[model samples]
Target chain A: MAAFALGWLALWELAARAGWISRLFFPPPTTILLTLGRMLVTGNLAPALALTLYRLALGVAIGAGSGALLGWLMGSSRSVRLALDPIVTALHPLPKLAIFPIFLVLLGIGEASKVALVALTAFFPMVINTLAGVQQIDTTHWEAAANYGARGRALLQRIILPGSLPLVLVGLRLAVNGALMVTIAVEMLSAREGLGALIWLAWQTLRTEELYAVLLVIGVLGLASNSLLELTSQRLLPWKGET
Target chain B: MQITYRIAKYLKVVLAVLLLAACTPIGEPATPTPAPVLVRVGVLPFMSNAILKIADAEGFFVEQGLTVELVPFRSSNDFVPLLLQGELDVAAPALTAGFFNAIARGGNVKIALPLTAFTPQDCPVVVVLARKSDVEAGKYASPAQWKGATIGISLAGAQGLPGYVVDLFLRQAGLTAQDVTLTALDPAVQGEALRSQQVDLLYAAEPWITRLLAGDDVVVLSRAEDVAPDLTSSFMVYGPSLLAEPEVGRRFATAYLNAVRQYHEGKTPRNVELVAEYAGLETELVQQVCWSDIPLDGAVNVDSIMLYQEWLHDLGLLDRLLSADEFLATGFVEVPE
Candidate 1:
């Protein structure tokens, strides 16, 4: 896979360098790497990366916590599920980007609005996935827990949570990606410092090398974040491997 | 079950409202249109777009039997492609290399009107800002001290208006591109960056420039007009569809010129109020900043545009240089005798 990717990069570099493709629009990978080095040495990359991560972390935490809480409640109680299903179904289909202006207006065009947009984007998938996870658990598990005198929070902690852990992890993994995407998008739209804003600024100035470097950074961050989540899931759910 | 039904009913209503909102135009005609021609105008929420906003707000477009749909863009660079693709009937973009490159690539958009001309008095539209601490510390105090100073520009290289203006200042100061460090920073964050001491200087635009100047930690170093007086910065471009329909072009030019005339009446409370409402700035700030000179007849200086194009071509950013006659649509706005 690495070889194939490198081969593709080499082809792109040749195309750009040979003038088959305009270097003004898409600089070669070597040029992008050199630009990346300059950005790092100039102390531009660290602050932007740090700010983007900070926003993503807080946003996903807030969004996932609330989504999981609500999803679990809706899954456990028929009444709650019935009431929320209609609203969730209607909202989940709406594009999160479209409501960004409203968030900007309500939260002010600061860190708050960008964080809120990421939280909103992450919220939907987390809720939907966790809800599906909870619903997929057998009624037998619930009955067994109830027969053991495990009711309410006790039953939830012992059976419902553990049983649904696999699916919830999946949801969390998905939500992280969603949160990162929203974070970058909002930053691009209006931010002083972030990877997305860096990409936009580079594009506007016709700095194709800088643009590609930033894009590569974003891709690496996404891959690294997802891999971290997967590793955590593996450690926590050791029994899942056996199953 | 009853609660669930009620919630579902409410959800249905909300969904209906959202769908209806998605279908509605931003600037719908007040009177019912028997058959109104829909004109999608691509615009940024900037003071330079005061004429377009006025035309919409004052029913100038509606009076011409046009349903002007204002499509807001974050940057003019984002909409030039859309204009070429026929998604936007008209666009007012700052004369940047991106727009010229688009035109060089056979983009069908034509310069229909000149938007803003800079003068010494009205040059606050684009200005250089520096950290107050730097100024007080005697850093970047003179044009000769510009060497090694980190300058935050709003876009890549010297292709953007801010970059061009900054370059003009540097040249006048006997400095070259090697004398300074140019970082691509967004205007939205330039103020905070200045305050935090991340950048020593910033080339920024109004609203941001106005807001930065108001900050205790920032000071205006120079305005664009100081370096390049009477430099035409923005132009109104008509999409191929609009250019093909001469009647639509004529009506739009007439409506736009009407607003320009009103704006030229100069800083009346009513004009300031309209500009403030559109640019999302306070009325006081809008009044305080210098307003660029917009032609009443909506005619652009073709010679100036050609000079700008030649400069970009020489810079190698433009693949092809377009002739003024090929890129500009004349006769829409009558030239004054």
Candidate 2:
């Protein structure tokens, strides 16, 4: 993987130096790295990265928690599912960014709106995944636990939750990624600081090298975050064969 | 049959070779003429873009021997980066802190032409707006009473032009930034914010101002010109590549100046019609909308730009003040004799 990436970068560097492409329009990897180093020394990237991660954490926590609870309820009950399925289907296809203006009016243009946007984006994926996870379980799991005199919380704790754990973990992972994507997007639209703001500002000021550096940081952070989630999910769901 | 086919193919090849030789020069190498310079201009769909649009519409660019492409941008915020990336050869975004910062950091972009200036006339460059309920309630009865009021701006802080309006207003009213709240709100929702009482006041430019005034509940408290007079708000900028080719830059300037002259020939019916068409407004609204004051010959005021930069530094928005020579592209604009 490293070799493949480096080979392409090397070719780009040669082409840039040979003047096949203008440096102003597309800076080489070396220039982007140098600019990234400068940004690090200036303390520009630290706070932005921290803020973006913070927003992602808060959003994912709120969204996944509420969505899992609601999805489990709907999955367990016929009337609840019938009532919410329509609303879910209608909202699922709608882009979250389009409703940002409404969010701004309701929540005000501050941390609240940004967090809400991220939460809202993550919410849909979590709801859909959790619902599917619960419904996918065989009725035998529920009946088996109830036969042992398990009732209410006991039945839920012993059967429904454990049976759905693997697929629910998948939902949580997807929701976290969704939350991060929404967080970055909202930050770009109206933030004073964040990786998204850094990217937008760099683009606005025509700092091509800085823009590419910030993009690289975001990409690495996203990969690391998704991998961390995968590791945690594996430990929690050992029967899933380290997936 | 086979022999005849082979003979015909060989004859065709021989004839093609002869034609090529006939087209070739016998002696000395041929000198190639340079290709015509193509300029990609970034413009906002606003009345302020009248000069550029007119130059394009009237064939002035073609007359000057330059091919110009005008790309419409939604905001000035998107203009600078594209210009710097060489995707755009020219742009005329407002003189915000971002532009100054780019220049201070040694970005190869320079102020090329003066696009518009806030004049002494009763032009509507910017205005302070208040809700009718707030006005009637005597909330901001006096300028000093503006304390503790929530003022919505399209962009807040030293980076935005409205921040200067806040500065001038506070200075006039004997207040400071700490005395009130300044929130960055979208101009699209500024009127709604006022009507809903989400914000106490706002600083907005024309069209929005005109649209908001059409409602019974909004009133103009003051004009930006009255507070900060004779200021050049926005101007054209060019990347280094455009400047490196002296003749291309001159031709662009010449064509632009001709349009500016036509714009300033005193808003006749035709001029009003052109403004209306470009700004996407009715002709009557165009007449009511105060046109920005620009120099007839399109010369940027370097001293005013210096003063603006000093103010930006004082506000802590700019790290360092760039000298006039460093900021301005001298000799780009040829003064009309």
Candidate 3:
């Protein structure tokens, strides 16, 4: 995979250098990497990256925690499920960025509004996925756990949690990715600093190399996070087997 | 045998059709009527762009053998790339560091005519306004008082005309942008920001300025003209397509300057009506707000533009400074005697 990636980059660099594509719009990879390095050396990239990660972390924590709790309740109780299902169905498909103005107005055009937008966007995927996870837990596990005299918290801890671990991990992964996306978008709309704001400024100034550099940073961030989640899932669910 | 006969019959019919088509007279020869040169103009719905509308409405473009299509755009950030790519033939975008940077980076666009500027006698179209409560409490009565204040502007960073105006306004009090915080807010919502005290000062222009003043909650701190007399703010630019066709560019400029003459006629019923129609406002509202000044001769202020470039370069906003000859395309139109 690494060799294939290098070959692809080499082809892109050659095309850019040979004038097969516009260097202004699609800057060569070496140019972008050099720009990225310069920005880091100048202390421009770190703060923005740190702030983006900070927003992503907080938003994911709040969104995923609430979503998982709500999903568990909705899955365990038919009344809760019926009550929330309609609201979720109605709102889950909403384009989160479309309602960013409402969040800005409500939370006052500061960090709170950006964080709230990220959390709201991160919430739906988590809730839907975790609910599916909880619902798919085998009924036999519940009946057997209860037969062993387990009740309430014991039955939840010993059976429901163990049974739903895999899908819960899936929900968490989705929530994190969604949170990162929303955080970047909100930052682009209103923030003074962040990877998204950097990209926006670069485009505004017609600095294509800087734009590509920031995009490369964002792409790497997404890949690293997804890989971490995948590793965590593998470690946590070894008994589910390689398949 | 049947298939061979069928193929022979089809070939005969095809040959006959081809021979008839070859012998047909396409049309009678006559004097050619040249189609009007279509020019795609990107414009924002602002009074500053009234000349383009006036030119179209008053038949100046038709007289020049040109067809002008006005494309409405929301922001320079949206249309500038199109302009650079030659998708837009003409646009009147505000002077910005990004524009200079784009030009320095080999963008095939050039300033063709002057559009709007700050003249001493004109109504103050652009002004700095402070919250009424702050002004009354003596918090921001003068430029020196601007220290530590959060000011709202329409564009991000110190890269555009607003930033230059703000810098000039600050220099009067022997202060710079470092003494104040600049916040990027949409012009439509700037009044709300000032009213809600989200920002202490607002660098804004007409319509918004008129509406905000009518509410009695914001007071004009300073007019932009008072600080930088005759500073050019915006100009008409021609993309590569228009530049390549010098005749078309000349005709477009001719029509544009003729419209400028009409624009200077000042609040005629016809002018007001046309401006209202193009700007999407009521005639009364159009008459109420201050209009921007476009020179009758359509000559840009080169020194003022150079000063803007130098200031932006000092702020490290521009990648490199562009020479007047590099960005300005001359000889498109003659200066009035």
Model 1, B1-337: lDDT tens digits are 9999999999999999999999987885586644778999998888888778899999999988899999988767766667766889999866666676656655677888889877567357777888887788988768989998878776443456666677788988899777997765555556666676666788877777667777677888887877777777788889889999998898888999888888989999989999999888888898888787887666666766777677676666565787887788987888886
For model 2, the stretches where C-alpha displacement exceeds 4 angstroms are A1-54, A142-155, A193-195, A201-224, B1-37, B104-106, B136-138, B156-158, B173-179, B265-269, B282-284, B315-319, B330-337
Model 1: how far is B3 from its true place, Å?
Answer: 92
Supply candidate 2's per-residue lDDT for A90.
Answer: 97
**After aligning candidate 2 to the native by TM-score, how far in Å is the CA of B201 from where it should be?**
2.6
Q: Where is the poorest 10-residue window by lDDT in model 2 chain A?
A: A199-208
| Local error of candidate 2 at residue B40 (angstroms) | 1.3
How many clashing residue pairs are found in candidate 1? 1
B269 in model 1: Cα distance from truth in Å? Answer: 2.5
RMSD of each: 18.5, 9.3, 9.6
Residues A126-218, model 3: lDDT tens digits: 888888988998988878887899977987788767777788888888888888888887777778789888887888777889989998899
DockQ metric for all predictions: 0.06, 0.16, 0.24
True contacts kept of each: 0.09, 0.16, 0.22
Candidate 1 residue-wise lDDT, A110-145, digit = tens: 578779888877788888888888999998997888
**lDDT for every model?**
0.80, 0.80, 0.85
Q: Mark the 10 consecutive residues where model 2 chain B has the least summed lDDT.
A: B154-163
Q: For residue A122, what is the lDDT in candidate 2?
A: 80
